[model samples]
Target: MVAREQFQVELSKLRGDIISLAHETEKLLEKSLEALYNQDIDMANDIISYDTKLDQKELKINEDAILLIARQQPVATDLRRLIIALRISSDLERMGDNAKNIAKSTIHLGEEHGLTIHPALTDMKNIALKMVDLSIKAFEYEDITLARKLSELDDLVDSMYGEIIREMLEETATNPQKIQHIMQMAFSARYIERFADHTTNIGESILYLVKGETLNLNE
Candidate 1:
């Protein structure tokens, strides 16, 4: 019984760690966008440098989760809890990479002259950032209903992505001189869209943890 109690305490600590990682990932996303929107290459470079911190955080979560699984030998929902912790950590870590890629795009964008930031990209970034936050909340609260709502938000992000692509295509044909800048903005849009997909995956992971079901929002 003491061992079981110890396992619960460790499990709670794992949850706290995942939430902290999620918070850092959320900040990364925000700063990546701010760097691009404001044309701040130094801030963008800082985000790129900060990717190492996120990787270290993920490694710590994995280490603790593995130790708990091996020592506690949890069953049923307890086992699911540990598995989802690892999965969510990976998803959050990937979100960090997405932010890094967005930051890299900003560096390329900064070198170009006479280019306006794509308005639709900002809209996509706002919704994707919200999805990341809400998905983390859904996991923390074990709220399957909140998880279910994320797919709709993801759909909105997709629509915004579509708008950005159309604008990019039109601008490319009309203003060929800005092709380099336009393409970089398109890459940033893709990064944000991919981040939204990762957030949806986190929501699905929460559903699997809470109710043992699969949700494929991509379909």
Candidate 2:
């Protein structure tokens, strides 16, 4: 009984660490999008630099989870929890990378263009951020319904992404000289779309944690 109690404590700590990583990654993504909107080169640079911290957090989580598995030899549901924790951390880290990519897009865009961002792109950003928040909540509560909703949100993101790409393509045809700027904008939209996908991946992980059933939320 004492050993089981200690294991539960460690499991709780691991869950907390995963939540912390999720929030930090979500914040980084928000800042990255803001930097893109304002064309704040300095802010974008800071986000790029900050990504290393997220990487370290993910590494620590991975190590700690591995140690728990090795020492505790958890079976069945306990083992599933640890495995899902690792998967969630990995998805969160990838989300951070997508944010970093968005920051890089901002830097590449520079300030000289004074390009106006598309309204649809802003919509994508907002939905992506919301999905990240919802994903975390769903994981915390192990709400399968909430986790399933992420797929619907992903659909919205996908639609907006397609709209952005089509519009950008139109702009590129008319203003061939601005191809570079248009390309960067498209890349940023793609990054935001990928960020949403990762959140759905987290949602799928949550479903697996609770139901012990694998799902493809990305579809």
Candidate 3:
């Protein structure tokens, strides 16, 4: 095969690896939320255990991307593709860490806390997950409009996060004994909010790859 053809193949494989990592991260986020909602210690532990797999997947993607750049010495659009892949993979890996953090928060809350999951918190999780999904789609399609839309979704997540925090603070004031549980719930909400922030980063990455300019969707 020609060198150009081989490069194309490697590029395609890199894209596939990124998509796989994205999907795995998304599932991890979903499971973490489920464990929090159900207060399932066992499930939370499993999610923590599964986080290592995401780490490995991310490492592989990073290594593959680096090797492609080294071997192909890609320039212009090809170079941009590899760079964006690296950025997206890093974002996805951090997103996985946030999910792991959420699982840890669930464990910290413990089964005996008897704390009810806040509806606003649930809304944050749902919107965060949707943002994750849409970010991947925007990257796959190179859709600037879809990528821009993620900031709007992220704004919603931020709004919901603030609502959860305010409500938790009010609850904590009324029931000082449950302050620890409330703090854990607040941390989980922050993690979800951060997860959405990373999704917005991916959206920014997509925009950069397509338009060759930097845009701060996080702001």
Q: How many residue pairs clash in each candidate?
A: 0, 0, 0
- What stretches of model 3 exceed 4 Å from their correct place? 1-3
What is the lDDT of every predicted structure here? 0.89, 0.91, 0.91
Encode model 1's per-residue lDDT on 100-156: one tens digit a residue: 999999988775457888877878888988888789889889998888888999999
Tens digits of per-residue lDDT, candidate 2, 33-100, equal: 88988999999999999999999999999999999999999987788889988998999899999999
RMSD of 2: 1.2
* Candidate with more favorable, higher lDDT: 1 or 3: 3
Q: Return the lDDT, model 1, position 181.
A: 87
Model 3 per-residue lDDT tens digits across residues 10-97: 8988898898888898899999999999989999999999999889988898999999999999988789999999999999999999
Please state the error at residue 166 of candidate 2 in Å: 0.4
Residue 160 lDDT (model 3): 84
lDDT (Cα, 0-100) at 15 in candidate 1: 96
Clash count, predicted structure 3: 0
TM-score of each: 0.96, 0.97, 0.97
